[model samples]
Target: MVFIYVLAAILLLIGLLLLDYALGKKHHLKNVRFLNFESTTGEYQIYTAGDPLFQDLFQDLRHAKKTIDMMFFIVKTDDISEELLEILKQKAEEGLQVRLLLDRVGSFRINSKIIKDLRESGVQFAFSETPKFPFFFYRLQRRNHRKITVIDGDIGYIGGFNVGREYLGKDAELGNWRDYHLRLLGDIVQHLQCTFFDDWYLATGHHDEEPFPTETEGEKWIEITATDGVQLEDVFESLICQAKDEIFIGTPYFIPSERLFKCLTDALDRGVNVKVIVPMKADHPLVKEAGLPYMMRLIEAGGEVYMFDRGFYHAKVVIIDQQLCDIGTANFDRRSLFLNKEVNTIIHNSRFVMDLRLAYLKDVQDSQPLKEHIFQLNTIRTKIKIGIARLFRPLL
Candidate 1:
């Protein structure tokens, strides 16, 4: 009789926990208030690895004259991060108006000593929506996953690379980190600066008093779509719906919501060639497991899936009909598509699209094509693991 009572109590506890989790997992895609698409001209430089990317960023930091704002999902305490901190400290001392906003959960392991030094040096910093109290438990499900940097209101960066040695392929565990980052110069950067200030005000409750650059017309068409958890899918669907030829997606996570899966299948039915690339060695096993089912469906629906084996493929990029390209921090997974505060750029330039296409072709060369039989080979235990992982995808 005691054992039965204890079992009943444990089951009740589990039920309540699931209910709490479900209540917090709200999909606000339809409610996302995307900033109006600003049409502008800009020069774009794509960075695939860490060395040149960091070099470009450091140069931008050094040359920044008026103000600097940075927001990232993760900022580690490694050499890369230390160097960036040092620059921020020096710039702040020089009166450059440096500010930083990081995600509390993403940078939880960052060293407090480094943070203290930064504050002592006059560098302003805050975490985006820090978890607190009863709200902390439920609010922890949401995250600000944008990676943005604006310097002098003239330059901007947005992509997957974070401030970490691992991102530079310096970690011993994860060999080489493959990712994509973009550098932009023009009036479009003002949009990035405005987005940064919007998030900064939300995090610190302080508005930026600095003046933004005046908008000017340029040579190429570019739109920066910034969205929170509520409207994450609007930009994606808007872009995908306009695809007339081919669609290429490269991301680390592949788990798709049913609605998005249906959209892709519909695209395939319309004779659009859809191809997806995902990391072979995932940082999260459960995330990888959750994606297998989606991969199978994509394969059966006349779409292609490629497993990137060169390294941990962390690039979130999409190319449509070789005419438009989107490069930013949002992945194809449900968390990135629906639950995180994400940012992406829709580049309407044929030259930029061609460059991304060349890179995608090179990546496909290093990847293995996934066939339908790959799913059939999974054992019962693996299938069960996938089912369990799917249940947790909402939280991931």
Candidate 2:
């Protein structure tokens, strides 16, 4: 009887999720917001792990005069995280409004002492969302995976590096964490701050009414786009459709939804060069297992898949045709594309595009191409295993 009841509950949960997806497809998919911002002119800089990423972040926090807002998927209690915490505490003590948010699931291991110290120092900090007993199944599954830091509403940073020692390549297993982050100085900073504020309001009942910096005359075009729940399908669709000549994507995970898989195959059919670079070894092995079939299908359709062997490739970047690019926290997976909240910066600058393209080329040199034998589905059991894993792509 207990087994029957468990099965019934699982079926009901799946049914409810399907119904929600159906309703969303009928309504929310059409009204998807395509965000874009054309700043008067802005300064942009891209950073890798060893390129003073944390130093630049601490400097921005120290220089924050009016307000500082930060959000990340994970924030550990390691040296890097503690240094950041101390800086934010110091800034808060200096009468500058400092706000920090972390995803409950991702930062569950954060030290309680740091939280207490932050609160004692007047740093407003909170977890994005916590799943309770009754709704634990659904609530805990959706995470806020965006990384954003806006200082004084004039400078901003966004990308994949979470606040942890491992992110700085201090981990024994994952040596030299390879990731990407961007520093922006322009009117678009307010938009990034607003994204942080939205999550802040959701996490805490208190809403911040501080005014963000106004737009100045700039030449760069940057759009800070974000999505939560079932609204990101169209945003990604638009991106794939916009790629005319070639598409270069770098992500840690590669579990594409069926629609996206079809779009990629279509892109390949149209003679567009589709190159995907994923980590050779995933931090979560199941992510690798779940994406195997899709990656095989992608390769079968004439698309190229490369695996980065130097270090853990955690950068989420998409360069479209050497003319446009996207950088942020969203991975090429069902969780990032459909379930979790993610943030990305869409840039329409030829110079920046070429810069990103050059980096992609360099990374490609360090990657090994996917061999045909590795993707051979010669056995029925192997096919069954892959199919089973693919079914759980959303949860992976």
Candidate 3:
């Protein structure tokens, strides 16, 4: 009797949590606002590796004259993370206006001691997407996944790379951390700076609304899109539906929304060459399992899927017909697309898009082709995991 009662109570708790998630999502959609996707002229540099990217970023940090604003999904106390924090601290102590914002749950391991030290060092620090209120379960899962930094109101850094040793590929389990990031100059810098301040306003309730003058000189046309738990499906679906010849995608996660998946299939039916590159190794449980069915559907639709064997492929990018590309922190997954705050830059410059396309093809060369047979689910354990992944798809 006791065992049966305990099991029933456990099931009741799960049911209540599910109800909360459903209601919270409905509430989030009702209140979410979409940002305008207008193009901005800017100079850009893409970074595929961590070492050189950090080297360049650190150099810019040292040269920042007036102000520095930094934000990320995760910030650890590892070597590179420590170096970044120390740089921010030094700049703050030097009387430069500096602010650092991290995702509350993502940076929870940072501990009280580190927060105290950072405060003592004069760096203005705060946390974004902190859990609260009626929809506690859903709020806990909703995070701000954007990683962006602005310096002197002219320089901006944005993309998938978070501040950590693992991002530098120090983790023995996931070697050679493969990712994409961008450094920007010109009017786009001010755009990101404004976005940072907007998020800062949400986290700290201190409105710092000053738009610095930025000169636009570069030929590259870039558009930054900010999605607040809604509009991600529409954003990607719009892009996929517009592809004329090809669409190349690279992401660590592969779960796609239903309409987005349909748009890709429609593109494939139009005889567009669709190729996607994803990591073979599963960094998180159920993510791989969750995405497999979609991968199978993609295969059936004459699209191609490549499993990246080189390293943990953390790049979140989409190249459409070698004329447009979106490269940033938003992954091609439900959690990133539906539940989290994400920022992605869409480039309309043909030259840069072609360049990114060539690089993506090289990643495909280093990957293995995926066939429909892989989703056969031959083992019981695999089948069970996939079952759970399906049941918990919203949380994925």
What is the model-wide C-alpha lDDT for candidate 2?
A: 0.81
lDDT tens string, model 2, 47-88? Answer: 988449988888878877898888889988878888888999
Better of 1 and 3 by TM-score: 3
lDDT of 3 by residue, 299-347 (tens): 8889999989887999999999888999989899999889999999999
After superposition, the stretches of candidate 1 with alpha carbons farther than 4 Å from their true spots are: 1-9, 22-34, 209-211, 214-217, 372-377
lDDT tens readout by residue for model 1, 161-275: 9989889888776678889999988878888887888889888889876548734345788888887775657677767778888889998998877877787888999999999
Winning model by TM-score: 3
**lDDT sort, best first:** 3, 1, 2
Q: lDDT, candidate 3, residue 120?
A: 90
Model 1 TM-score (2 dp): 0.93
| C-alpha RMSD (angstroms) for model 2 | 3.4
TM-score of each: 0.93, 0.88, 0.97
Q: How many backbone clashes does candidate 1 have?
A: 2
Model 3 residue runs over 4 Å out of place are 372-377
Tell me the deviation in Å of residue 292 in model 3.
0.5
Model 3 TM-score? 0.97
Which wins on lDDT, candidate 1 or candidate 2? 1
Question: Of the candidates numbered 2 and 3, which has the greater TM-score value?
Answer: 3
lDDT at residue 360 of model 2 (Cα atoms): 90
